[model samples]
Target: LWGIPLLHTEGDERTDVILGKFLKARDFKVSQALAMLKNCVLWRKSFKADEILDEELGADFDGMAFMFGEDKEGHPVCYNVFGVLQDKDLYSKVFGDDAARFLRWRVQLQEKGVKMLKLEPSTPNALLQVIDLKNAPWPAKKVRSVLLKAISLLQDNYPELVIKNVFINVPWYYSAVFSLLSPFLTQHQKNKFVVTRLGKSTEALFKLISPEKVPIQYGGLGRAGDDEFSGADAPVTELPIKAGEKKTVELAVTTGGSSITWDLVVVGSEVSYGAEFQPDQEGGYTTIIEKTKKISAQLEEPIRNSFKASEPGKVVLSIDNSLSKKKKSVVYRHIVKAA
Candidate 1:
């Protein structure tokens, strides 16, 4: 299962590992685990889950779910953009008359995630899921029905394949819905869930994942089609801006003939941002790189800019959050490229 040899002839160790997963999922209840394993095997054969990976569900479901960068412990992260289903035309096409096709495609995505795992007892075998519910049809009858069925299948058949389920941009109504459903959930299942309200996604995600691995749409330093910086580049840094105060981050350019590139984002609210260069020598002039501009609260992407220097200096990036009463966190990273 999941590309791991399940046959007894394969190896006793592999079989034991597989059994251990089921056992752990059932809290070490041997009989319960065995029954669960039997059900999973039967379901796999009936559902053709192993072959779903070979099927192409096409681009219509592309925006629904996808595997992205890994989390802190190297568990692969899968992002589910529930908001994409808001498109009525596309929604009807995928989840319409019947949800079977949609369900199969969702399983395919899960299988892809499982393929990346070692499925061993020692390694990190589960996935980290980030479900963005912004503008999602949370209250829709069809949406609820489809998702509930999918969740049931995953919980029963997949069995502890997800390390964490982080739900971001959750609407206010969700709490009420969760309250109604919480009693039905096992404590173990409840423990794996994390909920973050709107405007707090970046802050919540940063706690579980590095900013560089997180996508920019979630207020991280990462950007799509980025050529200037890669995942293996310099580590991202975080600075906190106190309410009604300004904070400056300085990147010292010890040598001339180099270009400094930076990516920055202010979480939660609008802030005034600017950049400048101060030469090291006595009485050396300061050069303004970017004039102070107000970054709106709705900004979906991080600010990326570059500056070339001919003299030794320090590039200062300023974030002024004086207008807001709430403290904000800034995620940023910089690179010094030789000219």
Candidate 2:
């Protein structure tokens, strides 16, 4: 009979007593049973089973506990747990009858925006057969081999769902299967599913599987420092361009009583810009010429004042349509003489 609680803790004397009685009845080594009990406690804490199940099932209970119950003769037996289900029929449907109801519940939860579920690996072989019917890509021989290993591991973990088979090989398919099942799995269970691929393919697979759930920081272009300065009343402005279109803008580098060096940086979706400089006859001033191959808005010139020019003078900059087949150019000029 099933007598395992849905959850357990390290200091629970009742649990220790239960474990001792179970081991003694089976004539099993108490030390081994104690070790298994320790493992179970660690697993429960790591998975936060009580909180996770509560959130997933939307129920209030002290906690769930699991245990490996035994018969009067003290032999290792199947697993069992304690929990109250509102829909007994639904519960039986999901856990019983080859998990037919369970799979359907998965689909239904997906439709309702639920995104993950967990099930014990020993769950009726019929249920595994059904899951295989839907997502198994390997040959029958390979599926059986992998499933047995997975189920064995699941049994060791007892109430925890087994997910190793999902990642054994063919990560793309595994991710796909998990993504499809995400709506039915709990957050903790969903975390158990891992994608083993690396690099671009893995990125693409993740994007394909959970585009909406992907973190925002991973996508999108970053803004340039020049844009922030220009917007803050700096003496520079960004020129706009269209795809294949070119434009030039002027920049003002104020000496502000000291000589400073400046750099021009172009910011565009897909455009490149270059700059050339010419010095004045007095050797105290210089002009910077800037050019762009296509049209786009970019911040150019981090102005640094160096060597006061003493008199009013002008610096010329230009941008050319390098990206266009027809070949056109645009120019911008800035004057940074005294004031």
Candidate 3:
């Protein structure tokens, strides 16, 4: 459907891949897959799906959904934040008596995500869907109905386009809502869903995405503004701290006139953190880069800091979790630049 011929006679890998998607979605049933293909083509022509990309859906929906970094398998990650609908004005606008506009905008986002897929026989042809349900108005009947309709439309027409539907920051009562949705979902679809409760999304996300690719808001090292490192920076290393324990990461400054930058995140709870530069020379002084401070559990952003070395020394980052009964995971990365 996405610019590839679906006929069996085409004999091309792209066409076979397109046909395989529908077949897999319908449990390899040829008749049902063919019927789905026909219906999708018809629906696309009627809904002008091909032309939706050119339409400006407005800035109001900008943060509602967005394409972010890729997953471990190189599939593009699409984040859908339903929390935006907590705004009364936005809630009424998108989920009011008419959901057509909202549906169109949502479909348009899916179309954009689909474009990220390579759709070849070997490459990753699906997007990872992360739906943030934090602060969402789940009790609203109108919003629920519109969400269901959008989900149905996407699942029907965009079969096999998503690797997983991860619902993060889900409330306690979400299980009840999921029970209702289960009837409409196939076993295959059900298996693709992943749900995480409040405060645990960061841990869940890290298992699927790299620390640098994950946004800092979800407890990873990825930050948006004036970042010292980019996507090409060194990979993040993980450190485990047992309850009532301490750990230090040391970065060696082998030469003088060098600069070191680092980012670190402590998942789950508050901890005491500090940094210092220890010189290698005998009887040399130690410089405190960051004062030992009690980082709060509520801190949503990762720690980023830098230091310039005038002489040979090592930058040591210390994390203390003695006050916490639970073990903690630390994710961090560092870069050293020579002058």
Candidates sorted on TM-score, descending: 3, 1, 2
**Residue 335 displacement in candidate 3 (angstroms):** 0.2
Q: List clashing residue pairs in candidate 3.
A: none
- lDDT digits (tens) for residues 100-201 of candidate 1: 888888899999998898777678888999999898875666666677788889888998889999999999987765775577667888899999999888
- Which residue pairs clash in candidate 1? none
Candidate 3 — what's its lDDT? 0.87
Which model, 2 or 3, shows the larger lDDT? 3
Question: Candidate 3 on 114-179: residue-level lDDT in tens?
Answer: 888778889999999999989877655665687788888998999999999999999977777798
What's the ranking of the predictions by lDDT, best on top? 3, 1, 2
Better of 1 and 3 by lDDT: 3
Model 3 lDDT-worst window of ten: 224-233
The CA lDDT of each predicted structure is: 0.84, 0.33, 0.87
Q: What is the lDDT of residue 237 in candidate 3?
A: 96
lDDT of 1 at 2: 67
Please state the error at residue 191 of candidate 3 in Å.
0.5
